[model samples]
Target: MIRWAASLGLILAITLAAPGAHGQSPAGAYETLRLIDGVRVLMNPADHASFASSNVVIIEQADGLVVVDSGFSRADGDQIVSYIRSFTAKPVKALIYTHWHNDHHQGASQIQAAWPQVRIIATEAARRGIDGPARLEGVGYETNPAWEALLAGQLRDVAARYQEAAANPENDAWRRHRFGQAAQQSLDGIPALVGTRLTAPTELFTADLVIDDPLRPVHIRHLGRANTDGDLIVWLPNQRVVATGDIVVSPIPFGFGSYPGDWIETLGRIKALGFHVLIPGHGLPQSDSAYIDRLIAAIADIRTRVGALAAEGLTLEQVRERVDYAEQTAIFGPSPARQANFQSLWLSPMTENAYKEATGVPIVQGQGELP
Candidate 1:
């Protein structure tokens, strides 16, 4: 399902057959998937009904837990805290953000409230995204009261749309309605959409940062820009598990604020890591690198095809029309709904980015151009 909210600067696309909602308790609002002894994947429904499409990873240590990706709202953070408490009484030692997307880190405050000593780690670019004005500028908006009002209104509108859609008997509509209800519920807690004390990263790194502990040794690497300019991947060498935030989303990938040309290379580096299990920022975990390969091929295909079209003096619009993604569409999902979602969420933005890169135009969103 594709829903556009100009006020929020979002083109929300919820995928089908998202991980089922389980382990729901007053403490955590998401489902938990235990990959190994100490590593648990806390997944939000991909249908977007819960408005928590991002997954939170929990890694157990000797003293406490290390969490990846806070979530989307204050309520989400509270649930995460409760979820953590339900399992163990240990405090969260660290909170790591894979990127700077709001959905991944907005709930930092909640986690911080519970574990005051937790260290929030992120790439330097991600820290800027949280502390600076890039988020508003990236979306072509300015940070101000008007912007906040627009976002609040957009959330309300989304809630209403979901409510109407939920009234339908169709399964997809019900999912949309559920997502809308969650969006509405999060409004009271999210403050303003952009411009707030967004629990900035306490620990920042440029390329790589390693946490060497006796129990769980974490290797955080910023491979290259993929999903976001500061995209980072968490590699648990011993566990052989990798947490890719939006960098390797399942079902369909997102292309907003992405570096298509560089993303392919970044994926290559991620593949070299040889992770046995992959936990994405959204959707379910993957046991192999099949999804990663598919995503790399899709982006590379877009760059090759769109770059050629753009080099031939074709405008972005023309390139979009000329680019053929039938094979990819089939591979992703040939159904009408999946096709629409893929085109809107991934294809269009990717084409534009590839076209700009090929033609020597600055990529607007991740170019560090702030107002």
Candidate 2:
């Protein structure tokens, strides 16, 4: 999803998933996936219902729990707090953000409320973005009323689109009604997001930061730029579990303002980590490099294609029309919903960033997108 696209911005993350549900979804709001003895990922929040959030991971050390990706809204954080309380009474020691995307870090306030002493950590660059002016009137959206109104309005607009589609004889009646219901489901989440405070990470490191433990040691590394300028991946050597923020999202990836070559190399480095269990920012837990390998190939394919197309002097939109990775739809579920997700969330933005790389255009954060 383009995190800060000009017209729609983060709203696309939800609306684009129209018929507003995951094609292959977790039955509950969030599922607990036990990687080893102490590692758990509170999987996808099917219960959130509106905006999509990154998967919140819980890693247990001897004394306390270490969490990755606090989630999108405070309500999401509340669900996470309840989810954690349902399992254990261990105090949360640290809340780590993989990147600065709103879906990954906006819920920090709720977690902070739960564990007042929880150390919120991010890479130096990510820390800047935690409080960066991503959207709205030159400020982050969580605290921006206009941005929130714009988002709610966009979802409403989508609902109207579906409603109109339902009445049209040209579109499928069943599809329209199904999608309309989904749009409404997303709109139902408006109240939960108001007055969200964008809590910035407290601690920062440029390269590596470690939270040492006898049982489960966390080795946090900023492995180049992938999903964002400062992307953090948590590696627990003892447990053999690695938490990849948005650097690796299962189901489908988000390519907004991502670095194509850097992302490919970063994933390659992640593949070399020899992790027994990989918890992506969203979706289910991964066991091997199969998904990582596929992601690498998919990205390389787009980079190569876009580089070649741009060499021919075609504009980004022209390149977009000429480029097609629909074959990847087979790799990430060929359902209509999945296809839309793959193209919009991953393909479109990946091609744009790769084009910038090839043409020597600066891909500024929150700038290379729809504005």
Candidate 3:
């Protein structure tokens, strides 16, 4: 069981986490967060991407369970499947690819091996994205589990600091938001990321499609481009739940592949869907209306901040820090840490460089700091 803690009169609290009771490091242990009765989200951490955390969701349907995104490797996939098995014996009926990022969909091969009948579904762009040349050659976790383990400790410490701040009366609301935001930011820097052979999808689509089962009727719609050029939203009209890929991570939206204009428009589209339970690619699920409001506010703030940086010709690092993720994070909340999380996957320099060149700015080389 997950232990949540807080202390009195302390503005800051600490959440002490231990390795899996069975002796596995915290990185391999899959912490399952049940979103609802039949829906669950998995948080997998690793030293990859500087030891950040990643998320995956599994939805149980009447026919079989539908997996939203897979984890980083066969090992990670096995851990996820093991967690699912602990809950129910149902096989995966369908594997849904929210986007083609490896962290989001690399476990398909293992899952398919277990459930060959499972159908693979994703957007056309997501399909190609998974099969692209940039695919990982091998696993990310085993590359440096020791160092990754050390990094995971730091993230845990960061999380602890965040929790501590959240308990302070004066910092309560603000710290909670920052904690969440920091969670999202911390996800990008994990170093233990294991590269994967990649499990590609079998089917793809370009338009809105409906996933109907006796259990639920999910309408998945694409919003031109946001998190990626081919991002999509999975909506459960009846359950009033929606799975928004990476388009809307907690604390703030990941802007690596973001077309600011399109991202903003996508937020409007999500709001129009009116899902009460909004499940983001990372972070906790939120209410549809409330989340839509939160998204709009955060994205607008990012736009304003980035726009100012662009106007002033500030570099990406200067630009990165100029846009205070802390404020938005304080308001929205933090995401979990995982290897190859969206923070690393989405915040690629290639994407950012492209965005800059497209906007007529000089290009820069390197991962973190902008030129």
Q: Global lDDT of each model?
A: 0.70, 0.73, 0.56
Q: What is the C-alpha RMSD of each candidate to the true structure, in Å?
A: 5.1, 3.7, 9.9
lDDT (Cα, tens digit) per residue for candidate 1, span 251-320: 7777776788789999999889888998887777888988888898888888888888887998877877
From the highest TM-score down, the ranking of the candidates is 2, 1, 3
Per-model TM values vs. the true structure: 0.83, 0.86, 0.64
Residue-wise C-alpha lDDT for candidate 3, range 149-235, written one tens digit per residue = 443454566555555544656644644564554444344334323333455567678888876788776676787776566788878
Question: Which 10-residue span in candidate 3 carries the lowest summed lDDT?
Answer: 1-10
- Indicate the TM-score of model 2: 0.86
What lDDT would candidate 1 get against the real structure? 0.70
Model 2 lDDT per residue over 1-120, tens place: 234432134333443343222334532255566666777776554433334567788888888899998776667788889988888898999999888777788778888988999999
